[model samples]
Target: MTGSTVGSATAARGLRWLGRWLLRAKCWLALLLLTAVTVWWLSQELILVAVVVAVGVSPGLVGATWVAASPRSFERLAAGPWRRLRWRRVITSRWEAVCRDAHLAERRRVERRSLTGERMITESWRCPRLARVRTTSHAMELIIRARSGQTVTELEAGAERIGSIFDAVAVRCWPVSGSTVAIELIMRDVLITPTIGTEPDGLVVDTVRLGRTQAGRDWLLPITGRHTLCVGASGSGKGSVLWGICCGLAPAVHADLVRLWGVDLKAGVELATGRHLFSAFARTADEAVRVLATLAEVTEQRGQAMAGRTRQHRPAPSDPLHVLVIDELAALTAYAPAEVKKEADRLLARILTQGRALGVVVVAFVQDPRKEIVGMRGLFTQTVALRLRSGEETSMVLGDGMAKLAPAHRISPATPGVGWLVEDTGSTDRVRADYWSDDQIRQVATRFRTGVQAVLITPTEPVDRQRERSRRVRTPKAGAA
Candidate 1:
């Protein structure tokens, strides 16, 4: 096995970089074309008049298209026995999107979408295109009112899905009610990540048996601090999962590369136990505030240092150090004052946004996931949700993508020492990681612990940013131009 040629294997794992770049380029081009068309159409005085007249003559006949020339036309399209029959032939036409929803801001009350609908065309349109091709537009809409004390973020999140897939539905929540969201896009964007150690349990540790035979099967796959999300309710082995990550990452400390920083908000009670492995930790909101303020300074210093470096080795992935881990990140938000918490969130966001290339990999754990905790759950390259109260919570934590990632594995504080590890497969393939004990955790921590190495936290991880963007912009290799 040691002599095995792993070049192709490893390269295959990383092919997503190219695929993503192509995809992203395609999206950028598509967006540009749309904008240009919109501008050109709007710029033409006569064309604008014609379009307005087109809309006025018959709303049903109007062909309202996006500036980007996307195939979104409000035409008088319809499906009947003949059209439906024809559609069956093109039924398998690929439709996809890489959907991303960021938490713009939280809303007070969330409205419940009214659950009512029938498959009768309330309206229709026929799209006029090359060869006079015609396609009809269908409407699917539902409305939900917000309750007095419900949160708006939850409602919109639910509504976004409703409008996109179930029905063109809207759920209004409290505060600024009556807002509507349309789900017209489907997810085509796929996130691909290199699968680091295939050894079972390598993605996570703590449960790796202490023997060569069964233990090798439990190799802890390091998430590369690439991006990890640890989820577990109050009692559900949140600490245990952290132990697993720590143990898996232990091999990196000696590289004079890996640097571990933690935000343990159990006032250092739960997370403090790992202090031997952690370089520094923020135990309270005040400590966190100070940590981030210092980190901001650190960022500038590293940026300067990186900027002055020679160009020959510019952006070498190995030049910058490796590793940045955050434990109990949400606690920083839950405990800090609004002003400080905002800054804290900003710092964490910065890490997630740009911590990759400086050889900085991030892993953050949170018990309860709110929109504000990490904004969009999809951002995390990999997720290790130990267990939560409900499937809704899990869906919110892992995105609907994890709908079939095994039934919501409920974990209570009593069972807090175990968790279910979910890696981003890009497609279908499921794996699981088991629970470990404190003593087992300590043993690995002791073995992996090494002397301190100052982490020069750079502001920009250029290589990471580029590679990540590429993965996000992948295009089909099946000969897509």
Candidate 2:
């Protein structure tokens, strides 16, 4: 090669090396500055250096002590910020790879000309930009601006992959705006520990404190004018949620501000223990239909009375809020005899449709959330989904697209009460209901029993047998004579 060509090649190589070095100059500069500062500090007098070191280290030592003593306080004050900074760096550094792997990045091809005038095509990936990172005690919230051709649904679909890459327990994504999405990385499972339910000191008619949310806030379920549907697989703590509501409304039940009507189709085994807390208890399909019919009638009566007077029903001593608790809704709606099922469905549809405004609400629990089983599932204003069997069931219970965001099916079987709460507004929250033991349920039932008891109307004996018995009693038996 000619000397001019050789010189050009060497210069090209040197420029490439310098370009690579400049890319990492910030890190190298920071390291060098830190080292220089350390050396200069060590060169000072021993006592002065010691004082400086102590002053610098004291905050860390105190912070460690605070973490050990009061982790909650430390988390709010110092640990949260530290985690935000650390996780922000980690997530930003891995953003490209994660997005690419999850198919959330758009690939572009660009044509460029080489130094020799040759054409070349290169591939480049454009990923969603991380706008912000916020840390909570057990989670990290990421706000990301979507790249071209990216949608919130894409982010939601890749939430599981993103969570796995970040070693998070779970990830939830929601749209913040037209071009922005917010993702929450659950770093820890806060619902592993069971929360204990306590009886309210005074009457609580508006809302019931059922358990604790993933964010460490009290999970208050609104009860006054809302219906709730609890769906979960067998052994998924459906009873815990049922009893949590009962326990929370104990004081109100005793004060006559609320009345519970329980229907336990499994031979009353589920709700029989808390019979005292219920004004009406049904163990048979026929009895359940009767109770539902009664509730429907009451709802209609209340509606007529308040048709023009008021739009809302307020609980009073004379007119209490009627809560119909159905332990196994499928038994009444899906598995019952044709006649019984038709009547039960008709009555339940009436109550669920019109009862909210009349102070009559239903809290139904079922293992299966299929539309065929509970056709009126959408009527409930609030829904709680525990460890469901599959994503399909989660979607059925909450709504479409909720399976990706809530993922109740992914909940550990060991954590029975852990689930996701979906409000009517389409917002979802991770929550766990307090486990109410049999002893606790009995205590609450006995302590909060209303003075009135339910009078169940059941089937009677045949008229022929009754007449025979009456004839025998009237004619005096031969042996007695």
Candidate 1 ranges beyond 4 A from true positions:
1-222, 294-322, 372-378, 409-424, 428-436, 453-481
- For each candidate in turn, the TM-score is 0.44, 0.69
Stretches of candidate 2 exceeding 4 Å from the true structure: 1-85, 88-133, 143-165, 177-180, 425-428, 454-481
lDDT digits (tens) for residues 140-194 of candidate 1: 1223333334344554455444334422221221223343222221111111111
Total residue pair clashes for candidate 2: 0
- Using TM-score as the measure, the top candidate is 2
The lDDT of model 1 is 0.46
